[model samples]
Every structure is written in C-alpha cells, then in structure tokens.
Target: MSVQLRHYFRLLSSTTMKSCRSNKLLANNFIIDFNGFYRNMSTVAEVVRPTDPNLPVEIMDVEEYRRMNGIECFGNSVADPIKTFDTYRWHPNLYRRIKEIGYQTTTPIQAQSLPIVFDKRDIVGIASSGSGKTLSFVLPALMRCMTSKQDLWPRCLILTPSRELTHQIEKVIKSFRFVRSICLYGGVSYEVQEMLLNKANPHIVISTPSRLETIFQKGITKLDNVDYVVVDEADLMLKSGQQSSFAHIMNNLPKKRQTLMFSATWPPSVQKLAEQYLDNYIRVNVSQTQSLSSLTVNKNIEQIVKVVKESEKEDKLLEVMNELVPSVTGFIKTIIFVRSKRTANRLVKFLKKESFPARAFHSSKHQEERDYIIREFRKGVIPILVATDVASRGLDFINVKFVINYDFPSQMEDYIHRIGRTGRYKETGKALTFFTAKNIYHKSNLIELLKETKQTIDKNLIDLTEESEDNIIKDDNNNNNDKDSGYESSGEGNDLDNDEDESSSSEWTSDDESTNKTKKL
Candidate 1:
C-alpha cells in the first residue's frame, strides 16, 4: 500500500496543474469549466430575492426600492424605510451621533420614515411604543432648525399624551445636541418652563397638550411661527381625554406647516385627526398586508396571546410560572395585569398560596402601599406583581422580563398600552395575554394586531370569532403538522402530542432554549 501511494503521489506531482481564478476544478489537470461560481459574486451577504414570491403592487412599481419586502405601506407615493442612516449627507454629525448611540440600523418604522422626514414630506406614521420613532422626527426637526435658528420661538412643536412620553422625546432631542428643547407638562413648575421658553428660546417644544394649551393661553409661548409639528402617540392623546386640548394646540400652530403624526394603532379618531391636519400626506404602516391602518408592533417583544377558557386560567398560570421560574427561592420580575382591583387582590393571594412572591397594585391600594410595592418590584424583592389598568401606563419597569395579562383589557388600545410596559426601549421581553370568550368583542382587532406583529395566529383564536361561546376551541390537533404549527400551550395540547398538548407548548420556553425553534426572543 505504501509503495502504490508513493507512485500515485509522484505521478500527481509530475503532472502540470491549471485552474480558473474563480473556483475551477484542478483535479488531474482536467481543465473542468465552472461558470458563475459563488466566488464570482460581488457581495456574500446581499439578498437578491424578496421574501415573498411576488412583490406588493404598490412597491412592485417602485423601481429603486428593494429592502424591507414584508413591510406594507398605504397612501400614494409611499416612502421606503431608511436604507442608510446618512439620509442628510450635509449634516455629518447625524451619522456619527447615530453610530455612537448604536442606531446604525433602522427599525421598520424608522426605515419608512427616512424619505418622508428627510425630504420634508408630511406623513402619518403608525409607530408603536419602543420603536425608536422619537429619533425619526427628532432628527428631521433638528435639520429644520438648522435652516431657521434665528427665530426667538420654536420652529417645531411635539405633542404627546403622557408626561413620560414627553420627557422620553426630550431625552432623544437632548442627546443629538443639534437643537434646544423644553418639556412642558404637569407635575412640573409652569413658571420654570415659561422662564426657559422665554430665556433659552428653545427651537423645539415637547409638551403634553394641556400644559402647552395653558402656556399658549397664558401668552408665554406661541406656536404660530412653528413650521414643523409632530403629534407623538396621537391615539393615546385621543383616548386619554385630551381631544379638545389637542385640537386647541393644533389650531394654534401655523396652518401651512409640515405635519407628522405617530400612533400605535389607527383608530377612526386618529385618522380623522390626521385628515384635518396632514394634507396630501403619506400614511406609513408596518405590517404584512395592504390594510388601510394597523397597529405598530414592537417585533422585539415575544408576544404570546393564549386563547383559553376562563376556568383553566389558574392551572395554566401555575404551569407557566413553574416552567419560567423553576426555583421559587429567588424572584424574577413578572407583572400580572388583571381587569379589576378585586381580581388583582385574589390573583396575588393565589400566587402567594402557590409559593410565588406576589404583590397587588390598584387604585384601591393606598398611595404609600402602591409606592412601596413599586419600590419592592423595582428592587426585585417581589417576582410576581398583580395589578389593574392603573399600573399599565406610566409605571416604568427596567427588567421585568415576563408580563402576564391575566385578563384582557376593556379595549384593544389598553391591551397595546399594557403590553408596551414589558417590552420597554426595544428590549426583548416575554408577554402572555389570556384571551377568553369574554373578549370576543376584540376578536377581529386582536387577529389584525397579531398579524401586524408576525406572530403565529392560533387556530383557536380564529375559531372563537366564528363560533358561539358554547363551542369552546381546544387544541386537539395530532397530525404530523402540529409540530410545524408553532402553537404551544400549558393546557390540553391544542395539538396534543407532547406528553400533554397543554404542557407541550414552547411558549414559556426558558433561556436555555433560545437557540431552539421556539420564539423566545
């Protein structure tokens, strides 16, 4: 064997070898032809095909647009998502600033905003919470300021629903250092805000509607000179009982100005408001279909909406918690949102009975007790928190990885607002909402919202919409495709294959299973 191998090696070495520069075979000097090989390509990472077989008609006509094939847009002449962060080449600092802050890549909302905002086109953006929408309008507002900084008043006015949102926008603007901004809202001194507005002469004003209306009424600030206006979280402001105040502020602004509105969901009220202010403007949406308006979903949140009968909730919750928090000795921050104060109290007691560190929060609780609970929750002293709608908005949780909506909110808006609590600042978090037949009113809207987020639509949810309450939808699928359906539960297997279908779901999959097929991220 050694002698034969040596003879073959000698013959191979003596033979002359030739090969093409781009991945041509040279074995035995065969002169084999290889054309257009992988090595001949220019970019290894470039995607040459869209995700779907056919591009949507609106985007198919766009000759230059190529990226974000899944994102749907409405209105004529829809702008594409930002392909590059250097949208304004003249302002070199924007590029460096975004890179420094790790916004080198744009989210879906930011992508569509690039052309509309950078080109000074009026737009209505359906941007969800924690979607980096603040930066989208802030950067453009900054650019608008560069053209007219000589003014003694604001050139841009930003109106949001809550004080928290107002300050959130202020923080983004301050980080850019391109323009000065003043946040006027309740719980802060009006005298101090007026002093800043008069003395500092901010180029951009961020405020809750009521405060700004008061400031305008007081004759301390004027928006007549403002050429750029943004209403952040328009739907929230509409729902939060500030419609008249918002109208007053909008009426006060200059008539002929670039208007931009961003909202989580597109309610009729929001659409009407946009129609009244934003003329000839493009409405940008982030979804899979060409539906008129849909909710903007933070794709980072691993949202699991479980459709279960009201009777099975207790057993399901216990099983999910056991999987998520195996060792009850230490606490992991988890919030359980209930519909009423009584439910919150009962749920917290039940969770404690099950050996989980749980606390209750609602309007019924005293301010001091609520404050103490919030402090303990923040400190990680309590792992499970049961609260009413009162804790849904404005309560900031830094690391609450899991959120359980034990009961559906009265409306879809509240549901969106409640889930927004867990997935804060584009951070990854897990949220599970228990949907019973009582929430049949939300069937259509919930289905639409789930589609917007690209989440798996459980067959049970669809069935709930079609059938009466007597016909309870259960996961009894046992076909070969059950594994492929992406449905997991802690109740009887909606698809019933693993030990018990209810216990087989990968929904509450632990951190160790992140690399697996389940949607942990």
Candidate 2:
C-alpha cells in the first residue's frame, strides 16, 4: 500500500483501538487523528464509522464537522448546519467549482439547508432574497448527481416561475461543468428546445412550469429518473396563477424523489401547496418570524412615497428623475413599474421624448424583444426600463440604482417584489412610489409595511378612509365635503393632455397592453 494510505489505515486502527479501550472517546474527538491523515493525503479518503448497523454511515471531514457545529441556526434547529462547502463530502469537481465562484463562507440559509438536503429529505426553506438561496440548493443537487452514476435522462429537475429565472438557474448549473443541463422556458420555439434535449440528454433540466408541462405532455421529456426536484420561488408559483401547472409537473415526477422548496415568503397558499405536495417535509426558516416579508425586505433600500393625482404621475416621475440626474454620474439604471403594459409603453415614449434612453418589457412584447431589452438593460445600453409584474420576481439585475413605482401595485406582496429588483446583493438602492386615490385600498397595508421596514410613512396616507369600518362616519363627512366642492384637487389636472402634447402623439393598440393583473389579497 502507498505510504499515505498506510498512514491513514494505521491512524484509523489506532483511533478505533483507543476508543474501544477507553469507552470514553466521543465521536467529536475521534476526528483529531484523521485531521493529520487528511492533510498528508492528496486524494479524499472516505472514513466510515459504523456506529449503528441500522442507519447509513456518513463520511465527513473532522474540520468540516467542527465548522458546521459553529453555525447559528433558527426554526426547527434540529438539523445540523454546514458552514462551509468543505464541511461535507462534496464531489471534487463540485467543490472546485464552488471555490472558483469565490464562495468561501456559507450564508445562513446555505449553512442550515445543505445538511437537510444532503440527508435526502424533503425540505421547505424560507429565507430572504439575495441570501444565497440559489447556491444552497444548487450545491446539494450537484453533489447528488456527482455521487451517482451517469444517466441518459436528467436526474434533477429545477422549476422556476419565469423564463429569466430559468435562464439564471441554467447559468449557475453550467458553471459546475460536471453535469449536462438544459434550460426550458416559454416564448421560444419548441423545436429548438426539443432538438437540444434530444442531443444533450442533460442530467439536469432547469425550466419554468408551463414549458416543462408542455414538454412532459408531448412525452419528449421523462421524469422517471429525476430523483431530485427543486421548486424555486415556491410562494410565487403557488399563488401567482401557476399552481395548476406546478401541480401537474409535481404529479408526473417520481414519488420517491427528494423535493426542495425555496421561497422568500410563505402565505397560506404556499402552506396549502406544501402540505399537498411534500411528504413529512422539514421546514427550515432562516428568518426570525414565519412571515418572509420581515426577512426578504431589504432595510437598506431608501423608500419614498408621494401622494400625487393620477394624471400628474408622469410629471412627478420626471421631477424625481431630474432630482436624481445631478447626483448620478454615468448611467442611472432604473426600473419603472406600471400596472399595465399600456402605461409602460406610454411611460417609455414620454421618457424617451424627454431624452432618457428607455425600453419597455412586458408579456405583450415578443420573446426576442424582451430578451434584447433585458440584455441591453444589464449592459447599461438602455438605462431606463418600464415594465409590468413580469420583471418583479426573482430575476437579479445587477447594480440597479432605483426602482420607481409609476403606478403603485395593488397587492402588498407585489410591492415587495417590485422594490426587490433593486437593493439586491446587499447593495444600497432607492425606491420611489407614486400613490394615488386609485390605490387607496392598499393604504393600510402600505402603512403596515412601511412601519415594519422602519420607513417614513406619509401622514396623508395615515388618515383612515371609508374603507375602515371604525371611521365610517368621519370618512362619510370627508367625502361629503369633497363632493360639495366642485372637485377636491391635489393641484394636478386629471387630463393627460394637460401635461404635454406628446400624450396625443403616442397611440398604442390593445395588443400592446398586458392582461395579467394582480389583485390585493
């Protein structure tokens, strides 16, 4: 036997003999002898300790065990934590790829979730956005593939909410280069995706639910061999009109497969979906409270809300842009979110006419146009983008300076997702909201959110309206006083023509509008 191997065997023998004789050697201290052996050997040697005959033996490094024990954990802290990539027996290629990507220390979510995933258990992980949740699952999935034999079909399937998110997961998977993977999403030709699937025969498939369902229905992709399934942005999938598609995909997958669900928030809809789909799953919540809003909402984002008339929103937006112009140096990357595609297109035209290079992204645009807009926006070619809720989810845009709500979102959850586009990766950002009477229904929710995030709430929004049952009399009197006057004006005109002549010049068809609407819940 080689010297290193001989040394390792001798060390193991000595440790085992010492433990048996003393009857006081703890599993924790038994690592000391192996630490020296590990440093001397170039290749990883599996050290198995069969403490129990009924349970499977785990092979881990002594240093890794110590680091994992040092990690802090929350919610169902029964599971062991993994603080670093080196703490577990990861595939060599996967380990090298992780280090290459400059990931040294594990984030709180990664530290806590990796151990549960490695144990081959169904897990529901609740962590904030930009908390490295992607790598938490990616590393475990790759390791599962690496420790097994290669298969002709994908052994892992990762489902995301949007095409952009599918592409993002695909990019992360590709970086490992150990397993072949393909990205499947809608808005692209099915023929191309089919051809790639047949040719690559990837071991991992990252896709959106709708596209994955289409492929599954056609019998082009099989899930019999898929032992690992990851559902990213689980709350969005369950609540955002994609629940049926998600259910269809889950039903087709193998019943014995390991499923992992990651989400920023966990509402009743998500909880119901989890109970239906997962079997005895372990819940790992890194956030202090069960509500994900308290965790995912970035405290660094500077939020400002202006109560403006509906017609003057464009003017107010322009004024805000002008104020930011002096402080911004080269390119001011901003995302302006509107309620409808019509407003997005109109805002784009108005901004362009005022010398701001802008683009519009919504479901109405062709797939290629949307792709181009996203690429150019990322490269700073188009600094301003007016979009609908399509861009509100988990797609990470780099260095977004500001997120402006041209039209306030009807749902409180949507408002969180919209601002989440900026202030990502721990970078400071700003969010400006243009609130009008149309959004008065969300005033209480907005006030609560602002207070939760420690943001300055406007006093005008604090006043209770007729919607509040307790203030019905006061609200009725206020409404009567307003009706008595010709119109209680906020010093802004209701007509779009009052702002500028450009309003008449721009004309759009109904096809250019987004039909997807979100309501307050």
The best candidate by lDDT is 2
lDDT of 2 by residue, 1-521 (tens): 65655565565557464556433223322332222111112213334332222334334443354344332233342345544556565566766677788876677778668767876778888765676789888887777778776654788899987777877788888888888889887756678889999999888899888778888999887888998999998776655566777889999888888888887766677778788887778876653322233334666688888876656777888998877843446558999887665667667777778877777776655555556778888998878888877788777799898999887764666777788888777688899987766556667667766776789988766763534332223444554344221111222122111111011211222222243432221
* Model 1 spans with C-alpha error above 4 angstroms: 1-69, 76-81, 288-292, 298-303, 307-318, 325-333, 340-400, 420-429, 444-521
- Quantify all predictions' global Cα lDDT against the true fold: 0.64, 0.67
Model 1 accuracy (lDDT, Cα): 0.64
Error of 1 at 216 (Å): 1.9
For candidate 1, write residues 1-521 as lDDT tens digits.
44533443453345332333543433331222222111112111111112122431111212234334345556665543444453334355655676677765566677677667765688887755666667778888877786564765688898877655665578778887877888887654678877888888989988878878888899988777888899887776776677888889888777888999876678888888888888888877654233424455566678888887667888889988888854555766888877655566566667777888787765444333555677778888877788766566545678788888877765676677678777776688888988876567677777877776778888888887424344345544442223222222222223221110011131322112123332221
Question: What RMSD, rounded to one decimal, does every model reach?
Answer: 16.5, 10.2
